[model samples]
Target: MSLTYTYFKMRKGFGRQPMFCMVKPEMVDNIMPDEAEQKKYCLRNPVNQESQAVLSQSQQEINTTRVVLTDTGINHLEGGWPKDIHFDDEETTSRYRRRIERDESYVDAIMHLTPKFEHYIDQNNAINMYDLFYKNMPSEDPVEKPIIRINNVFRDRQCRPTSSIGWTCEEDSKLVVSYCDKVFPINTPSRNTDLVGYLWNVELPSSPVDEFLPPVACWQVVCSPVSAPILLGGLEDGRVCIFDLRSGNSPQDISPEHIAHRDPVSALLYINSRLNNEFFSASTDGVCMWWDVRNISKPTEAMIMSVFSPIVNEYDLANAQPITTLQFDKAFPTRFLCGTDTGLVVNVNRKGKSHNEVMSAVFKAHYGPVKALHRNPSISKMFITCGDWRVNVWSDEIISTPIIPGQPQKYQINDVIWAPHRASSYMSVSADGRLRYWDFLRKYREPIVISRLSQHPLLKIKAHDNGQMIAVGDKKGVMYLVQLSDILVYSGNKDKPRMIQTYERETRREHLLETKIKEIRLKLTKTEDVGVEAPPIDEITEDFTSVESEYKRIVDEEVRNMGPGRTLSSSQLEKVKQEVRKR
Candidate 1:
């Protein structure tokens, strides 16, 4: 009995039932033999039987061809022409073309072809099949309710606060989150406390893939965009350390205590260099240091906080304003921006050769310590600053006020970051454990989406380079990986141009405001006594520069002429002081 059949062996109750399937006509033709073969055999029963009903079945593994495709280029100097014609000769080409045009057949062809061309042209103009009918369809606004989804959650075994989160590429997407006691000075932890940080794989997110131990409690961590194993971080004790995931837990390089900051490092950023190993660190000690990973013993360069750096006495150092945050642009390597504990935003220019050459332009930014200053990647001169209870959008053009002064939130904003793709949007996490997504293009005064991701206070939030994933870390050492909606990460064609228009309109408004302020100040300095003067400024002028200088000069003279029993008089000084209002 031949046993070649596609059906399985008949089993108990259910399998005993007869199977039914429609056989395609072509399949029946393929199964049946030719007329000559059929003539040799005669079936007494045209019904199914064990051996006679067996179906022929054979498996053929598909063979793949090794197609090595080769590409070649053909360079032809000119089109094909008669042997009598020289293609490069302009005169000969023109004569041949004129002859062809003058031919009777060519003339007849052109004259008769017009009707057919017109007919098709008319048809094309009458109705275009390719034209989109739904081009004017109203776009759906982003869902009023938040669409953020929790993709993954990673927990720390030791339960340390997640200080920073950074992403880098490897065999799998890797994240390095620094774990340490964020409430360090207020509630000091003992020396024996564990300060181990974790390196996590996004795919296998149940636990950390690797761990790194810092010499001190690590506060901030950043991964190199090109290197998967390399990590740079700042410690709570103000020392900067570098770590390698391939090596054991210990840091690869750690800065020395003698040259380290007197306070914990607040922010760190990589600066482009020849070796790609240099980075800058800002600390609460009122100092910023640039370090090379290879030689971490001493900083390559250092700068004082400049905002409140000048120490007039021992009291100044004790009460000095600290540098809380830093922002740098690669395009402008000579200058960088930093925020002070006194809420001053200072832009430091390193290109100056002279020590006293106007180093920075200071802007009073906030009422409390500035927490974050993230530059708008698309808009070079604009940036957002988070501090106290508010977030404000600022431009380099306006030093007096923010371009978009947002209202204060219910809670202090801890961290804020701009969306990687959206030009007019950013995200902020507050101390109230709520994450707010802001789209200025939709509305400027309030955030569009407010989602509470954690019960604990959120420390930081970072978006992946692709703008699809967001990893937010809270105070409890829990990291939430979130998936963003398409609207938050994508922009329409008009977004960038509209953003530019908004910025420009605000910039012009600020310019007019500054001009008005100057006029107001001029009016405030006006003196009623015009001719009773020592060649004073305008009687109705705003600038008090001349008045201030003259007052200084008179005070200095009085101080220099101080005698044993002499007292200061306001007779002559009183006249100058009155003219100055001492206006």
Candidate 2:
């Protein structure tokens, strides 16, 4: 399939240079024109005079096979023209293919097939795209016009999320949970069928829960082992709140039976969901504390103290290093792993005489900083996602290397998650925006399943237990729930990755409105501090009226795309897919 890239100037220039960027293949076409032709091209002194004069000098000039490489000659040569280089020798030797294929690391593998394109080219497809006249040198004409830029784009069928429930599960699920700008519904079709029955949101804000102050952050509900209900919640004022799923819903803050850390909770995991008291919480303050609900507010044990490096500590001890991930063993409740910005992986044993004690194995996991860590559910020795685009597997019995015995590459590892219910397999999202599934028991150089959904930079990924579906959320506030089979069969087989289906939602506009309202409320609250300047009640009323009008317009546009008929069926689905494929 061909990939078409629609370039938009986002922020215009970077360092006085064009901010050139590429869109993911799934967003456009991916096929390149394979035109094999031979031609001799030459650079011209003056772009306007000599070239025009020669062309008009005689009728034979019209049919002359010649190219004028103007000041843009530098770009033309660099772009991809048969100048100074022999096309016959290059193509025959497959030099281009060899250079791209040599990148065998995980990061290079995903980008290997990404179509290469030039930003600008002359009308004759010879001169540089950025050429302009400047003191006989070249004027930096930011606008690279009269450029023949051909993008290798191909059309494919549009895809859809397979879940019966909508992308966000907004059907009957009333409340939306937001973490770091990503929103996930508490009620999931695979886990809970009953909309109201799921205990996910009970702790956040319900009727009875209202008795207690609303939780500063939304509560995340997780299924213990199988069907047991457990709440891994964050509270306002940076506190971790663990709630008993059995606790009935009513907006009330049931103080946590165990207070584990002194920071806003970011992630929570139940060591053995079957066991009510066993759980762990990761905090923004870089504290990974273990707890038993029966215990006191303070943690009984903790792993890896949150401390700043010497340089940082010298200036400020309050803002220590931050913790990113903390996960417990899938089968063993006592064994666990924690990751941090410091890029160190601390393997620990909770059963030790002291709580949250690290095991002998602690090592640097990533090139830059570690972003995510997940232990495979099926294999004890195997886990995935350390940092840069690499995945590592470790065993108690270390060999020559601490990492998995395989070739490693550079790629931003944003998310590493075990395949739903499958420990032998795992799914990960890289900085390149590619989603790949791997099996430790299998070969390392190539992923068992690779997806080229590089358009949106995926920040989070969630897979269903059955392995039939996967959901990815990009940095752009767009969430995608894709059928696993579609990605595997489509991108894997055809060497092409296209969106099976997509639904995008953004809260920026709503957030802006909320910010305005909050500002007004703040002004009212601090009226005395502002010298009692009312600016006239009529003016205030007019300002509010204009705001309301703008709000209505924005809402109407968003609502149009999210109408009752927004629902799409198989017929309409295939039709849309065919349309996208044609383009």
Best TM-score goes to which candidate?
A: 1
lDDT of 1 by residue, 328-433 (tens): 8887787888888889888777666443333457788999999989889889899899999989999988999998998988888999999999889999999888
For candidate 1, the clash count comes to 4
Candidate 2 structure quality by residue, lDDT tens digits, 403-470: 44335646667777766543345677776767777644343456776767647566667655455556
Worst 10 residues of 1 by lDDT: 308-317
Candidate 2 global Cα RMSD: 34.7
lDDT of 1: 0.82
What lDDT does the true structure give each of the candidates?
Answer: 0.82, 0.49
The alpha-carbon deviation from the true structure for residue 400 of candidate 2, after best TM-score superposition, in angstroms, is 7.4
Model 1 residue runs over 4 Å out of place are 1-146, 184-192, 308-320, 354-358, 528-583
TM-scores, all candidates, are 0.65, 0.42
